[model samples]
Target chain A: MTTPRNALVPGGAADQGPASTTPSGDSRRLIYGHPSLLAERPTHYCPGCGHGIIHRLIAELLDELHLGPTTIGVASVGCSVFAYDYLGIDFVESPHGRAPAVATGVRRTRPDAFVFTYQGDGDLAAIGTAEIIHAAARGERISVVFVNNGIYGMTGGQMAPTTLLGQHTTSSPEGRDSSLAGYPIPITEMLALLPGVSYAARGSIADPSQIGKTKVMLRRAFEDQLGGGRTSIVEILSTCPVGWGMTPQESMDHVANEVVGVYPLGVLVDRRAAAAKGA
Target chain B: MTAVAERPRLMKGNEAMADAAIEAGCDAYFGYPITPQAELLERMARRMPELGRVFVQAESEVGAINMALGAAATGAKVLVSTSSPGMSLMAEAMSYMAGSELPIVLINVMRGGPGLGSIGPSQSDYFQATKGHGHGDYRVPVLAPSSISEAVALVADSFELAARYRTPVILLADGIQGQAMEPVMPTFRMPDWDTASWELTGADGREPRVVKSLHLRPEDLEVHNAHLQAKFATITEREVRWAGEQLEDAEVVVVAYGTAARVARTAIERARADGLHVGLFRPITLWPFPSKALAELAPRLRAIVVVELSAGQMVEDVRLAVERVPVFFHGRTGGMVPTPSEVVDRLRVAWALTAPTP
Candidate 1:
């Protein structure tokens, strides 16, 4: 299964160091651009948020994979709710938590289409819990770009199912105690346990190097959908500057120092070996 | 087109609908059997494969409509038939298809509802059919046919509407209408498809296109919604359909739709026997609802009684249309269908009180 791959940023080797990879001198700082399939606009996420970076990574992958023609994005109600506007791909606004269900319908019907869903912690873990789990269990051929931003971002940061212990949010103003909140649910771990899932990975955009790697994994998820295999989810650890009541830079520091410890990033499931076996 | 030259035969409304769907080149039929309309699925299960179509007996109504959407995205003519509760299950998938602008047909042999309601014929989903059947700022073209023959014609029309509008189209009738037999002379035939405009024929002949409803920018979203609204506005102008009977010098006009409209028409004719001046307003397209025609009739009539199987749903439209013309309502919820005589009696009682013996 050979495809024509066209890299958007020439491997990102030039993107090195602490000040953060700024796309290069006079090359336009807007990470995701016109040629990248995303609609150019100020994202609806908080300052220093990972959603923007994640969107850029996905956009860059869409360009590289040549999935623009077949790309279909299912938008759910969350911080990534306005993803459709940015991705500029064909989109379907799914009901709260039903993005997976909607994505399944699109994938099953348009099997040739590269179908992916953009969802948040609450939208996936709570309201749309059944749809995502069932879709994964059924091994529906679709990709989900799940953002576990710890706290719900849209309606002022509330304690999400993915919110870590002692993390403070609007709903959990007094730090989230594990006993009262009953522990943060690691969605990737839960989903990976199911045989239906093909890939499950968590990544944060706080660091420049990790963001580059996140794009590679995101591309892999979309490839799984396009190749007509099993379900995949790339859970993104996003940031909340306004919700956390800090300047954008401070929030990035918070994700690097505080949030990273609780939600350690890694691949929970990988079916690449099985994919190789099948081939 | 007439290779079969098939002789006209008496058939159940639901079965005629299924046959018409097959004749319209429907590529797939997905459904789970339910009371009153189960025979329709029986007919499809027998004939679909022979016609080179996919007929799947889905695990549930949820699965059935989802399958229909899957088949429809490829621009395959698809139909899913169900009763009331099954329709409620269908609502979620229906909204998704509508949002994504996928064309598919839904044949709703309506029963009573709220819950487990009734399997018997009821025009109770008028509100749901006209409204909540699809979520968001979108409209489903709901077509109502009274007789088996109309079901044949309406099913074909629904597929056409679904294609033309790029939205879900409901061949919305009830159990009574679904099971009734009537004379059907196949007038209009299914047109050979032209997928040049819209249809996911895939990346074979041209560049691959993705149909989705994700709008991230507020301005872009506003533009998309406006574009959809414009299409709807065009729908209202070109798609509105209804028929009026004996309105000239009549004392009352009975505004009804679907199975209830059929019953109301019979009652209107019966009342004429007793020399009561009565007319009928029957809506064929319940969504762009024959409002203009009804509004025009409002000035001349004494009053309007919205006869339905549900609790006065379409009556709200009548009230809006006839503002100060005095609107009266008669309905029975949960599977109750008023007979011709019952309707005549209601009309007589209303006639006596409204304009008196003239």
Candidate 2:
């Protein structure tokens, strides 16, 4: 399988022309190629689902970082449960909401291995709130990739813990009333308050520019954990077109216009910088 | 690898088990503190870090069990100990471990519970342990040790059994056994497991190994369940363990396990001295239930009396094992332990009922 045309490159994919090969016929300098760590098989993710985009980013980083041979991934329940199938890495499928705890088990036992947990809103924010919080508080040497799509796409568009206050879904048909459902939790910000978290960031993939920024955030998270930092996390606000009852373009727009407002982007915490300065 | 002690040391059963686990080369331990078995976690906390092994006092039983599952997935020998209420909290992860076929050792220092009943010794979790504590079709080999020394030996065996079968194994004890102080010989088996085929170290030189139980298709799940059932069947055939005293010529045998068996041993000895033919049959492997062994001796015994700390939980398994043999049950529940004299009284009645009418 060939890499997508819009795949990330050093100077951004938009700057390169259709000529994928390098001028001197050097393979390493080719503009775009398939990620080495990603499997060639087609994924089961829905069309225009942000999970594919996020998976590609992670695979690309794993390839660049040479972590494919030493990375152990803990895949949480939900659409991303099949992450092992697409990531081509050793994976332990954890129980719903327990990926962080599972990752801790792996990281604690195999300190040389790079451990990460990929989780969704329902898996991370709702049922797994305690696991995620404690993992961050304990400063577990693991990276967490939290994908907040505002709805349970795999379970047929149920209201998620990260769903916007006025968002309507199967479970919240009359629109989520703040009085009954309470406000959406800013889990990343709350986790950032913990001293153990070395890097906590929020990013979006609603557009190309945002995707690039989000990839940078993901790279920072991976690098922080690899550098022996405790609990690096990147929360990515993503799109779910089928679950949200909208076209792919409309869903991306909704993520950009609505989701970004509730969950703002950028690095909220970077303790590594402070630690470096203190040293 | 070998039992050797210049002088036997009196240690708490939980502590002895922890020492045995360490001697068995446990690579990691994750547990939450609970009554009765809190000493086990404390012992690990003190010893594991000293040995440069992994030890984590998890947030809760749920966290502890999942962490153990994760460690086990990495092919590390892992241990987790908790009491009944905590065991209840760990049920979900136990199910996940069973489905994933991860070989982690769990010690359930059972306490009285219908829901926070009491933190005192009770064997009420027989049904829970033997009949699948968690949902789904799976089995976790349950080892019941009656004394501190036996618990020590079984703790080592638990790891071997777990690795041999590629499944979780439970060392089921009661609060009495967990808290009792007895002289124990320092002994444990060394773990020699070859986990290269499935352990999740890295995919550098081999295909990536995935430890998961999620089979989306019903047919696929059924096949997986069938494979698990087959493994369980082999475990039953190869791993049935029980100990019997004076069973050769005894007319009546007392069937018991764990703490209840300890009391039954004294009762059987006293009854034998009183010229009544009585024997004690202790099923060490609770999940397999040692049914074949019990059934084999059923025809020779006139009657079987099942004693338990619970209100007759393991008695059901006894009844199933000895189909036609008259089985009597005596139980004490809600943390109330039956005395040796109490068990003797039940044995006397069963023996009298089965006596020949001359």
Candidate 3:
């Protein structure tokens, strides 16, 4: 509906234009087809890291939601440092742990525009803890793609806030001993109980089917943000193969089996009923 | 026109800066209230909404600066003002803006700091101002003005430079300069804004443009850095500005910048009255810090006295410009401004020391 006249290929199929009357026709394929927001460049995420899959799913969701060009992606520092390189939309590279604050500015200024922060565990849960908490507490109408891989990836496998108990990392070389390091942070569960967040869920890209399902959940979060609900976060149980010293498949299995046991996946807070009643 | 004369008056430097920001078409101002510059935030809060702009006190210095940087992405002339510690907190955003080349205006009403140094005047950030504090090889342009009038003029120019060069532009002034009320000509100039071709805001009908700093390949980052260096080189060519005082039959030249420069005027008179044959070279722009003008004075003078509020930071630049031609320096550290008499005393010592040197 927001398409300009000249965007269409000249003299091609009129059915292949944005003005297509049907949402389920060839014109719909033309309108909602192609990867409009995924960068043409190859991702540099280490193998088995689920960042690549999450990036693709987010782009696909944006295309489906018809919010690609208008969506401003805040790419936080960490493994997703090159996220700007992979996202074809307008991307603002955020300071470490400052993505939520930056996203708040974007959403508040451009209320009609779709704004989201793509952050890693260290960025969202550590130094950026206050930022994420305050933005969530303020009920900023922004979405966050929180990729929690259980261990810090980009910075030589340091102990992140999400580092699971008994997990061996560069910082916790003897493995995250519970008595020494304390328990893993159940971020989504903790945030979902808060009043500000409208939606909070945990999902993973352990397999292709789960990847497909995660896309649907991400779409819901984005829709919730667009529909004037409070802020939301979809925590992706990502894999860090290089840091974990395992193959990508093994890492995916690790997330599906080991990681999800600690960080359970479910909609912790659903404000749909509240939103609908208010409306 | 009858109503024009009846309009309200009595504005401070911070108030003038806010008015200039509004006139320059800045759509958003995100800042925290720090004394000597608090009125800037207050004025914005009052005026931004009436002019159909946005103003918000960000959670912290870090939050405010990042918010301004975000506003820059949508092609807004976003600005943020801060004191020393606050600017130090914003060090990361300064580097981000410099590297990403998003046009932003960062005003530093500098206070004392080697830590939470003081709430009073200091030029300790001279090193930080010229040197991009966070990370990277780019220098954010530093505009040092001596008065409120220059603060307003330089702000408009800062936005223009940020857009034209795609970098963060700093309007560096100390607390005294920020707090003092000076007569400013309320003149406004409208910059020709054609968003039809900016890299951000989707570039509309133009070729796709990228606004980022990540270059994985060595060759790519190297090329980007070289291109930026060349741009700064061009900036040096066109933007080296300063105010020169008497040099006819003079053997001593006092070098200063910003408020220190204005203070040197009185010291220069005192020194000349005492028959020391002294003059002044006041730097208007600090990063491109009047190297050519100072270098030109090296051979003619027996010595150059670099005066500042810090422990001789600008002296290094003078030495770089003049190349060890009996360079004498006088400065005070930790939130203390060098009084005119202190500067005069330094000049006397400099002339006496260098007079007997060769």
Candidate 4:
């Protein structure tokens, strides 16, 4: 796709142009903000942070699925607690690690509404381990968007549950030692073992093509829930440039290189598709 | 006048409260199984699905309370019940629910406990319930019901009070009340308020709604605290309720609440039959404490006797309310309940001590 000439214009001016005949005798179309984004102001994320890309993809999916009117999102603690502010949908902020439990309530009460939770690695893999495990075990028809940056970005680059072995974080200055810190938890794989979970996938946002793949995984997760499948989870390997003490380009390189080796990408489980194939 | 129900049926206090929650059109119930209160959860599990409402036996008390908080944020009439130790586990989420100002109803079927003391009845959580059970400068309107019928009525009223103030309300009962069966006329009605105006449905064509309790800035937190305080003041003024019996000509009055109040009532009657001028003042709303009414009656009474199932937890409040009048406490704890005769004996001693020298 060719980039628009006025792409850098603020407030998405390039996408606000009217349909007109191009010099090549083709009709031109403009694309503005995603229907579900409240892009009235800039985000609070650091420069080169992966949250912006992830948030945009979620907004686009909400628009594509037309779930804005009936979707209830649960925002977990950490960097994404303010997701409700940027996403043009109703939300309830859960305490650290409680988003799964909260989403369980919302989904159970409003079965007709699409419910999802946006959580970071620390929020889901640490304090909230029980909540997510039980919610999945109960087969709650909710989608979970897990962003694994391998560090506690909001709390200033501390080690997270998904921190890679030998990774240098503020809390693990000498790099994480398996003997002391144990190994990084592969939560998606663990959840996939549960019969209640209908779909589980891990993707990366390190490159444009990878980001596109991540969006596809998220869309499939949401579709599974919409089709009355049990719990669906899409764990996207993200980046935290400031927290990782690296440039944006270097951080993406790290996710593509280091994180991908420790936490492999691809669909861990897809019960519906597997069943169809079996039949 | 509201129309009366066709016929009263016999029900346990726990089941009566659960039935009342359904009649009041509760949208969801999330709770764990705990002794004395397990029947409430059992009833909800069976009935909520039948009525097309939601019910979940949460993995833990913490999960249950948080789930209720989440449902409440969506403007659903939510309820969660637990016993002493279970209530302790739910305190953190309860504080968050209060801070968020989301309306919810919590039923605590009192059991003996400093730490799982006993499954038997005790009022040890009086201080915890009335004096900011969780952590904060906030208060929950607590209604203590003495009988099964009153439990049903209070449970029904709790939903309305919660919605009216957008705050948590507690329907406090004891193990005795939870286990004992009595005749109750369950009345069903929808709440007389609009929940959609504040509840989170969806953004749709309007601004999105965010329900949260985190006030990071000091200034913003101060404002939130002030707003909560104002709401509490209004509730205290408008919602104080109690049953004052035979106080018109009594010289000695017994102040009690919940199951203890039933014993106090019998004690007062026994004293009255013996030609003793004793009355009973039973508080229904514990947080408001019926301070004004107690103070007004303090000047005329010679002594105020506080009867309780704990070691005099509520006597402190009685002392604060009736400064000049002498206050005496007679109680039991550790799953033990004081007999009516014991309360009458304490009343006599209090009366004798306060008698004027002639």
Question: Looking at candidate 3, what is the lDDT of residue A166?
Answer: 77
Model 3 regions more than 4 Å off: A1-43, A193-195, A207-213, A247-249, A277-279, B1-9, B193-196, B202-210, B353-358
Comparing to the true complex, what docking class would candidate 4 get? medium
Can you rank all candidates by lDDT, best first?
Answer: 2, 4, 3, 1
Candidate 4's TM-score:
0.94
Q: Per-residue alpha-carbon lDDT of model 4 for A77-163, expressed as tens digits?
A: 998887876787888988888888898888877778889999999999998998999999999999999999999999899998899
Worst 10 residues of 1 chain A by lDDT: A1-10
What is the clash count of model 2? 0
Every candidate's fraction of true contacts kept comes to 0.16, 0.87, 0.32, 0.65
Separate DockQ for every predicted complex: 0.16, 0.85, 0.38, 0.67
lDDT (Cα, tens digit) per residue for candidate 1, span A1-279: 112223234444233323334445445333432344555456656667778888778877887788776776777887677776676466666667877765665665565678788898899988777778878888888898988777778888888887878878888889898878888887788999998899998888777887877777787787776666699998877787877778888877787787778777878887865669889
User: Would you give me the overall lDDT of model 3?
Assistant: 0.80
Inter-residue clash pairs, candidate 1: A84-B216, A85-B216, A85-B217, A91-B212, A91-B213, A91-B214, A92-B213, A92-B214, A109-B70
- For DockQ, the strongest prediction is 2
lDDT of 2 at A161: 81
Across residues B1-358, which tens digit of lDDT does each residue of candidate 3 receive?
Answer: 0112233345588888888878888878999888668988999999998887878787788888888877776677788898888888999888877777778888999888788778888888999999767888888789998888778778788888878877788999888887888767766454544333543443223333445667778999999889989989988888888887887877888888888887898999988888889888888889888889888878888888888889878788888887768888888878788899988988888887776644
Q: Which residue pairs show collisions in model 4?
A: none
The residue ranges of model 4 lying beyond 4 angstroms of the native Cα positions read A1-26, A29-36, B1-3, B187-189
Q: Please give the distance, in angstroms, between residue B332's alpha carbon in candidate 3 and its true position after superposition.
A: 1.6
Which of 3 and 4 is the better model by DockQ? 4
Those runs of model 2 whose alpha carbons end farther than 4 Å from true positions after fitting are A1-28, A277-279
TM-scores for candidates 1 onward, in order = 0.78, 0.96, 0.88, 0.94
